[model samples]
Each structure stands twice: as C-alpha cells, then as structure tokens.
Target chain A: MKARDLMRRDLTSVEPDTLVHEAVYIMEQSGLSTLPVVDEEGKLVGIITEHDLIQAALPEYFEMLHSVTFLPNLNQIQKRLKEMAFKPVSEYMKEVFSVHLDDEDLHIADLLIRKRLKQIPVVDGEGHLVGVIRRIDILSRLIR
Target chain B: MILTVTLNPTLDKFYWVEKLPLSLERVEEEILIRAYKSWGSAGGKGINVSVFLACMGVETVAMGFLAGHTGQIILRDLLEKGVTANFVWIEGENRTNVTIIEKGKEYHPVKIHEEGPRIPTHAQELFLKKYRRMLKRAEYVVLAGAIPPGIPETAYRELALEAKEAGVKAVVHAGRRALWEAVKTGPFFVKPDVREELVVGDMPVRTEEEIISAGKKAIEYGCSACLISHHVTGDILITPEGIWEYEIGVPPTAFKNLVGADDALVGGIIYKLLQGEEIPEAVRYGMAAGAASLEVEAKMCLSPAAIEQEMKSIKMEFKEPL
Candidate 1:
C-alpha cells in the first residue's frame, strides 16, 4: 500500500535544545527509541535516537578515589559522572538516516529494508514533518 | 536495559498475488494458481522492536498482555527468535495483521490491520503494576504501539512518570493523546513521522533548518532529542548539543514489502547503544538496518550480515544550516 495508507497520522515529536533528561522521559513514556527533530515551522530536520542520548550522557572522565585495597575508584567514577552530566546530546546525535514524503511507499519500504530502520518520517512536498511509518505499523498492516 | 511491552501479540499472515482484482473470480480446476504465503509473528510495536533487537543480538525483554491461541503463536515465535518474553495471561485472541501482495513484475503489498480485543480494566491495571515493577530493573522502558480500546490515553503518561521516578529512561512510540500525554513526562527520545506531527498541529517543519528549530522546541517540552523520520527526504535529529540531518536515498533493490523497516531501525539503534557505539554510529547502523529490512518480503527484519553489508556502502552528509 501507499505510505499515506500505512503511515501513522498521530505522532510524538521534539525540538532541538530539548534537555537530555526531558527527552529521556518522553522516550520512556512513548516507548520510542528515536524522535523527529523539527524546527519552529515543524519541518523535518534531524532525528535523535536513544543511542544518541546515551552517548551524549556518557561520562567524559573517570575520578580516582582514595586507594582502598580492592574497592572500585570512587573518585574516578565521580569525575566521569560530572563530565557526562555536562555533556549535551548535540555532541552525540546522528546527523543522518532520515526519509521524506512524496517518495513512494514502495521506496520507503526499500529504504527500511536496506537501512534496517524502525521508523521513517513522512514529510510533505515542502519537506515539512507530516506522518510517521513504523515497522510496527507495517507489521500491523501485514497481519491484518 | 531496554524493556518492551506487548499487551497482545500475533503472527503476521502474508498473501502474495500477481494482482488484486476489485472482485475475485473463481478459477477453473484446470487453471493453475500462482501465489505465495508466509508467516511471521508480530503484535504490538514492542514485540516487533524486540524481534529486531534479538536478531541483532541485543539483550531485551518483551512483556505485556497475552492470551488465547494467538498468544501461544506469539510465544512460539519469540522463542524461535530467541527473544525473552514475559506476558500476563488474559482472555481473548492476540490479534493479527494481514498483508496482501499484488505481484506484477514489481510486488505491491497492501496491509490490513485488525483491532485487537479490548483489554479489561483489571487486566490493564495488572499489566501496569507489572510494568512498574519491571521498570525498576530497566535502564530504558519502551511503551510501543496503540493501547487497546478501552485503555486511557493517559496510560503511557502514567507509566512514563513511574519509570522516571525510578530513574529509568523512557521511550514512547505512540500517537495522538497517548503521545501528547507522554511528552509531558519528559522522555529521553520521541520518534514522530511527518504525518503524526501534522495531526498534532505541529506541522510546517520543512527543510533541515526548520527541522532543527522544531527539535529545539520539542526539547523545551521535556524531550532530550527529537528524531523526525521522514518518508521522502531523510531524517532530522535534534538534541541538546545541536541539530543534525541524514538523507536516506533510494535503495539498490526493488521494493518487496515495506513491513518491519522501522523495527529494524529500532533494533539497529538499540544494538549500537548496548555495544557502546556513539549516536552517529548508531544512526548509521539503524539506517543500514532499515534499508536491509526493505529488501525482504513479509514483516521479517533483515539479518545483521545484510545490515552490515549495507552500512559499508551507505553515505550520509552533514551540513550546518545557515
């Protein structure tokens, strides 16, 4: 079927500059690994997945604590946490792997199979964000 | 630890034909029939994602509502794929999705979705309780797909809040009220396609610059990053650091079935995260996985080898918007 038929009209999205913690919450609530990053105009721009957020949150340094016989280094762990806390998702987000609307549903399917993506954005002719087609959506269609 | 919840799951039925006539005519006994049939298990978004993750060798748990003969099928499929599943038993059929493929030189498949059985209030409550318990053990909780009819839109929101309180990351892959409500909980990731965004009156996001701006706005609404999965152009990712874009070009092979591509993407991202790959690397893997899924028929996700092969040839360009 065409993308318009298979795509999900309702969607959850986020804009850039969103706090890493807040994005984490949205992902938890929605059960989505990736979110469409858009502009004030709602145009499709980039995508941020759970991997990106996790990478952004990775600690930059490890702290070394007072030497205890076999205990792990508390100071190093603290240092790492501090560095990670300061890091932003922007430093880790992927800048690519997005799809557009106007492209055929067949093309989209091919992209998904070739790219192995779970979700593909449906943008309007102007490249504005429109709908989303998830592998689940396609699977739902297949089973029905 | 990514936890996916599948209240109901099922095996997908795929029927292939040379072409779908508006009306079917009976063929004579002498005439030969040309068609193909295939089956794969799928139900909620969570299960689909888990299947992909398992294929990619990512450790994951698939939980949710289950019952009836169809539920057995789902369990069998999960076991076959080596995915860990923990489902609460209930009454009713698990549900099914049908795919009709019109096979010419090119195959065109039409998907018909079946609404699952209504989830009783008590069962829903029990599932929620179980989910809350599971959330504590997970680093990431994925609440995927549409909640059965009779379920409240606020269900995802409540679950998300619970996860957050427990210091777990939440990922929501839902639509409409469910999606809007979940956003208030401040999830780590929100994946919305263009159509879903437009339905929410959050459209007009065109161009890379516009998408970046929108991603920033979503973060203001309590999202860590916004991943816009476009159909035609590519993808737009907005995070606290900055905005980035990836354009998915045409695939090398012809279209077979569009099913399971997104699940492949999810699987790819989760695999990378578990492996400690950075976001950019994860995106590449996700893109490759999605592309590979497109090449296969039915709802089956592509193999890792296929994904890796595609990853090597795929190229993505990054540019700073003016």
Candidate 2:
C-alpha cells in the first residue's frame, strides 16, 4: 500500500508564528508527537517535533548535566520554563523532514528505520499535507 | 492534599491574533496583523486540574513525569500557583503545546501538540517510588490525561491500583484506551468526554441513553462510579445508588474556550468532594463550574461567585431506580 493508504487524514496543525504554549496544547490534545507547521494556506512550511520542543526547554548544557544529578535545581528549571514559555513556535520549530504521497511504502519504511522516527507527515505535490504515516502504522499493517 | 498525575505534561502557550492573513500576499506590500496578546503557562490535564483546584482554594499537588527543559516550565508554573510539585524527573524533554486563536474563531482554535518524551523504564520505576512516598499524604489522587510513549497502556491502571493500595481514592478524567484501563482498576470516579471515545470500552456512545448505558457498563466493569458526557446530548453520572442526570443547557457563554472546561468540571467536583458535600451537590457545583468556564478565557481559577451564580441556572436531577 502507498503511504497515503495507511496515513491519518484528520490532522492537527498550527502556524509557525503561533506562540509556544498554544502549539503545545494542540499537540498534547491530538496526542501527536510531531506537528507539521503550515502557513495560512495549509501548505507545509516547516515541522515541529517533540525533540525540537525538548531542545527548546533544555539549557545548552542539559545533556551534559542530565546524568550528573537526579535532583537538579528547582529554581533553575522554573526560571528557564518561564523564559521560553512565551516565545513563538517559529523560534523553536525545525525545518524537519516530510514524505511525499507517491513514495513507496518500502522507501518510507527505510527512512523510518534509518532515522528511528515515530511518524512522518505526507504532503502532495503542492506541499499541502495530505496525511501522516507513523512507524506504528507500518509495523501494524505492512511489516509481516 | 489532592494529588494529580499527568504522565505527559506540557508547556502550554496561547496566542490571540486579531486577524490572520490567510491569503498569500507580497510580504513587502501586505501589512499583516499578528497576535496582540499571548499567555504562557504550564499545560497538562493534571496541571490544569491542580491550577483550577488551587484557584478554588484547594490544596493540590501536581505530579507525574517530566523531562528536560519543558518540565522545568511546568514545575515553575505550578510552584508559582502555590501548588505542590512532586514530579519524577526523567531523561527526555517535556513537550510544548500551542494554541492560536483568531478573532472570528471562537470555538475552533488552531492547536499544535508535541508528543512528550518517552518514559525510560528506570524513570518509570523512579516515578513509582515517588508515588509511593507521596501516597502516604495524598487522600485523593487524580490520574488524568495521556500515557506517554515507552510506557504500557496499562500505566493508569497500575497507578490507580497503587493509589488504592495506599488507601487513596482515585479519580480519572481521560479518554479512549487510557480511560478504559483506568476504569478497570476500580477508581472512585471516571469522567469520559463524548467528543472522544473509549475504544477499549467498545461502545459508540452518542446520545444521552448511550452515555448513561456506557456509564452503567463502566460501573459494572469495575469503577465505583462513572460520568459519561454526551457532548450535546447530556451528561450522566452512574453510581451504586442510581443515575444522576445533568443536562447542561446552552452554556452561559460570554466567551467560549473549551481548553480548561473539563479541568474545571473535574476540579469543581473535587472541590466540593473535599468540602464533604454530598454527591448530588458536588455534581451540581461541578456543573456550574463547567458552565462558568465558558464565560471567560482560560483562567487559572474560576470565580467562586460566578460558580454560585451559574449554579442557579443549571438543573440537576437525581433519578434513583426503585
């Protein structure tokens, strides 16, 4: 089956300029890990993922210090969250990857396996999001 | 203290735009109107519940999983509100959720959500350890919202069972598979939104009767009580005594945003329950809190007077089967 066959059509998306918290709520409610960022015309311009958000939340030395101690400073965490919380999603969103509708399922599966991605958004030739294919979709339906 | 569990907590952002230029225009020529107001707060079902509870003068503790930078935002937000934060620190970053509201779009706001960090097994174990410690003081525990990745769907069930083992009453406000699993653990109460479905329940609940029937079945399945919301149809509260029906007529809508309404409803119920009110009065208070939620933009707390006034309009009926 093509990627479109197994893709989810009903989508939840946001404009890039949308503030950070609004975008976060949309993703949380939709239960999507990644959101395809679109312009007003619904054409994909960029994409945001949980990784991008987590990166935004973390300080520069987060990875270096995460293993150092389980009890990180509470004051520092709160201060950073307050500072980054109001920023626009455009500031934190990544120009990440997307798949085309006509791409072969095997090709898409290769991308997923190579990248270890959970889901990839699908777009038409016009760059309009048609659907999304998740790794779970592929595993549940195609991976004999 | 009332403890709330948000397995997938998030950083919530709200943007209010006067007019969004939907059409493609020359960037040099078009004067685009961007957002005039934006609000930032911690976001999660459990966090929102704690926010509401704290606003209503209830002592609430916001707990669950947090990772990376966004988790800090959640902690700060909760601490700022004076809600206790007892979260299990994780290795991944918490997600950021955004909502974009245009002037004309009252009900349909643009929402973008990021899936939260996957819970490593070690982190999950740490959370259980924390939960055990917190349960010693927690009289009421609310296990709300989604179960993050890398965690089994039975996560809520196990948490509810743990709360029960600690002699704490568990309240669930969730949807679909998570709600199904939570109900099986025999929570004190379960509230399911009709717009969402309990897929594990295997019932396509639509009308009032369907909603009631579903609640009845949920009680039979295991939970002590169930509240099924038929969105526009009606809301049914099923318990061992009988079914308490509440029809929330057209909300007293001064302004409408559905974002925190469920949290408000659940918070209201918990608020009255903490005050030692009977089930009917507490549900009535909950109905008013929910209706009052529509009157304002998402506020940290609903006004007590507004809830009292809105309670005047809501008609709650108790139907005890003979």
Candidate 3:
C-alpha cells in the first residue's frame, strides 16, 4: 500500500511552543505516544515521543537507586509531572528521524521497522503537516 | 513482587526459507536456522510473564518444574538474566518450539511444538507445596499456558484459589477448562485467542468487531481485563474502563519469523505494567513488542531499544460500543 493510503489524513499535532503537559494529555486522550511538532505556520519541525517525555520527566536522583522500589517519592514524581506540564515540545522533540508525505508507505514502513519507530510524520515538500503513519496502521494492511 | 510459574520452557529454533511451494519433491536450499539461547525459565504462561517482569527491572520470582538438558539451559539463561527461580527438578527433557518461515509469503510461519517433560506425582506435589509457600510473598501470580498430559486442568483453579487466599492478584492465560475455572475465581487478567474463546465461551470471534464484543463478555465473567490476541487483526484489550484496539503494521522488511510474537506480547504487557502504565498503555507496548519480535532472528529477547522506539509511534484507539 502507498503512504497516502495508509497514513491518517486527520493530523493531531503540537506546536513547538506547546506545553509538555498539553502534549502528554493529547497523547493520553488520543492513545498516541508521539506527536508531530509544528511551528506557528503549522509546518513540521520535529517529533516527540513518550520516551522523550519520560526521559525529560526523570529526576536526577533516579539513576542512583539500586534496589527495587515503588513510586514512593511522590514529591519528586509530582515535581517532574509539573515540569512536563509546563515545558514546551520544542525542548524535547527529536529533530531527526522523520518522514515526508511524498515518501512511499513502504518507505515509511521501512523506517519504522529499521529504526523500530512507532509513528512517522508525513509532511509536504515545503514541510507543511499532512498526515501521520503509525505502526498499527501499517500492520493492519498485513491482515488484508 | 511478581511470581510466574513455568513448567516446560525451551530454546526456540527458527528456520527461514524463501517462498515455500505447496508441494515440492526437493526444494533447493534457502533455509536459514537461527538459534537463540534463552535462560533457564519455566516453559509455560506464568514463566513468560515473569521473564519480562524481570527484564523490566521488577522483582520477579519464577517457580515450576524443570528436567533434562533443556531444563538446565532454561535455568542458566534465567540466572544470567537476573531472574530468581525456584523450580522442582523432574525427570525428562524440556521441549523446543520450532518455527519454519517461508520467505516472501505473509504470515506463513509454521510452528511445531514438542511435548514437554512428564511430571511424576511426587514432583507435582512438591511443585504445589513450593507454590503455596511462595504465594505468601507474591503480590501478583500469573498462571499461564497449557497443562502437561499428566497434570489436571483444575491445577490452575487450585492455584488461583491459593493466590486468592493469600490476597495476591491472579492472572490466568489459558484455554478451555482452565480458563473457565479461573474465571469463577475472578482473575486479574484473562488473555485468550479467538479460537480459544470460541471453544470456551461459544462465542463467534470471526471479525474485529466480534472479538471486541467477546472480550467485553470475558470481562463481564469476573476478569478485571480481557485481552484477545488475533492472528491477523493484532490484539484487542478490554477492561471495565473501556476497550482498546491495537493492529500490527507490516515491518519494513519481510517478516522473518513469528515464533515468539505472542510471548513477546505478554512480555511487553508485563514490562509496561511494571513501569506503572495502565492496561491500555500496556497493551500498546505489548503490541509493539510482539510486532518487533517478528523481526528478530529467533527466541532472543525483543530489543528494548526497538520496543522503546516502536512505543513512540504505535497507535491505539478506544472502541466505541456498537
């Protein structure tokens, strides 16, 4: 199948300056882990994933824990959650490893499988937002 | 904190061949066999979940029966992976699950499962005793997979009861009698494939819509969550909160093998759950993990980096009730 056939036409995106909490909420509500980062012009600039948000939310002291521990440190957890609620997508969105709209669906699948990616943003020649290709969307084609 | 019991585990052997002809006298050689050495782990449903929980940095203990050379290998692998195991040594060899992949064809991997060790009555008693002792410390107990020939199907029900007595959350991942019996006790989770649901619940699960309905019904049967792993349609997760659907995308490269995809899915779900993700989020992680496992060489662990990357893009949606 072609990229246009597999990609979702309705785009859910976030501006580069959008708050991290808003991005997280969008992902949680839409059941999406990544969001395309767009500029004020609605042009694709980068992408953000749950992992980025997780790493951003990790406290400096988390790496020092050696034993199995529950999420007992509510103060630290809340502080990180608050930070994610305030920071902008521009601070954490990955600049590299994105796809364009003209790219073939197979090409997008290649990127997903090769890079082990979950979602790839599809943009126009001038970098305007167009669509999004997700792993499940591509996998659904296999059933057919 | 989590305990998984595996009775018959093995090192999966995967053979890849390109374009399998329906009936050929002597096909030319294009077959490639990749063997992955897995840790000494329990070979059933509970054990698989424990392996993943350990990988996700959870304090997990695995208990079950092991025997012969393959049994020893399972132990070695689990120890190396840092998973604590308390298995009863029995007589006989662990069985291997084989996958023959016909290249160029979609979903053409043929899986052949070997019968595992025969547990003597004495060993069975020992296992039950050990499990009872272990249940005291377990926060969650996952009873997974098929029972060996000599074992009664009611074994899972008894275990579930014991877990319930200890105030531990029990998750059952089996079919037929075991699944039906577990449901009476109200398990934390029940994951049945469509065929199993059809046989056990007498429900039609031909399409995605039917599967979702059946899954909801399973939840109504006292399970906290119902997960259906479809052969072609991916997976559907149904919880009291809502229903979520996850579909797999074709990998960039042609699929090499799908031998451990379901196990990988189980692993992914446990991994996410340990990370404190909700049921829906855990299912997405499981789907990505299952899909990623299809691209791996053999019985190896699904790449964590790959899963993390896939987690970023995998899409899931709540299914509106029809």
Q: How accurate is candidate 2 locally (lDDT)?
A: 0.75
Question: Per-residue lDDT for A55-124 in model 3, tens only?
Answer: 7667766667632274566677668778678878888889846667557767788899998888787766
B1-322 per-residue lDDT for model 1 (tens digits) = 5788755465577777775664546554444545675555655678888888766666567887666777767766775575665555566777788777776532346777777778788667656655665565577777777677667878888888888898987777766677667877788776653443543224456555566665666687788766766444267667666566665554533666766666666667767867888665677777777776777775645577777787865566554432
What does the interface RMSD come to for each candidate?
15.7, 17.5, 24.2
True contacts kept of each: 0.00, 0.00, 0.00
TM-score of chain A of 3: 0.83
After superposing candidate 3, which stretches have Cα over 4 Å from the reference? A1-144, B17-44, B194-200, B231-233, B251-253
User: Taking the tens digit of each residue's C-alpha lDDT, what string does model 2 give over B1-322?
Assistant: 7888999998888889887666777766866567798887887888888888878778677777767667766776776675766566666689988888777665667778888898878667756765676677688998888778898878888988998888999998888777888788778889875454533366777766676777777778667778777553246788877888887655433445657777788889989989999766788788778777766677433689988887877777888751
Off by over 4 Å in 1: A1-144, B23-34, B104-108, B193-214
Candidate 3 residue-wise lDDT at A82: 88
